[model samples]
Target: MGRQVLTWIGAQAAASGRRYVRLATARDDRPLRAYYERAGYRHVGDPPHAKWPTSLYERAIESG
Candidate 1:
């Protein structure tokens, strides 16, 4: 189901002329991080705000 959602999202982004998809998840959630990584998202970096710790990830949207 996750993969399906990602596929849909990628399609929508491509239709909108976007090149990448970006998301943020809790920094300490190892399992969730691994899941995103397995989905082809690469860890970009953390946001500069100190109020909350989050890990940023980005995946390139392939052109069809």
Candidate 2:
């Protein structure tokens, strides 16, 4: 269900001329990170300025 929602949101973003969708999650949340990975998001790395243990992920929008 979450994957579907993310896909839908990505679709909307892509339709609006966005090239990517980026997000962050706590480093300890393995399950949620895995979910995002399965949904086609790639782990980029943590932001240098973040105060917490956050993992960054980005997904490229496919051209239709």
RMSD of 2: 1.2
- Per-residue alpha-carbon lDDT of model 2 for 1-64, expressed as tens digits? 8978898989898989999999999988999999999889999998778899999999999998
Relative to the true structure, how large is the alpha-carbon lDDT of every model? Answer: 0.93, 0.92
Provide the lowest-lDDT 10-residue window in model 2: 1-10
* Candidate 1 global CA lDDT score: 0.93
lDDT by residue for model 1 over 1-64, one digit each (tens)? Answer: 9989988998999999999999899998999999999999999998888478899999999987
Q: lDDT of model 2 at residue 54?
A: 97
The number of the candidate with the highest TM-score is 1
Report the C-alpha displacement of residue 34, candidate 1, in angstroms: 0.4
- TM-scores, each model vs. reference: 0.91, 0.88
Candidate 2 clashes between residue pairs 3 or more apart in a chain or in different chains: none
Model 2 CA deviation exceeding 4 Å by range: none
In candidate 2, residue 17 scores what lDDT?
100
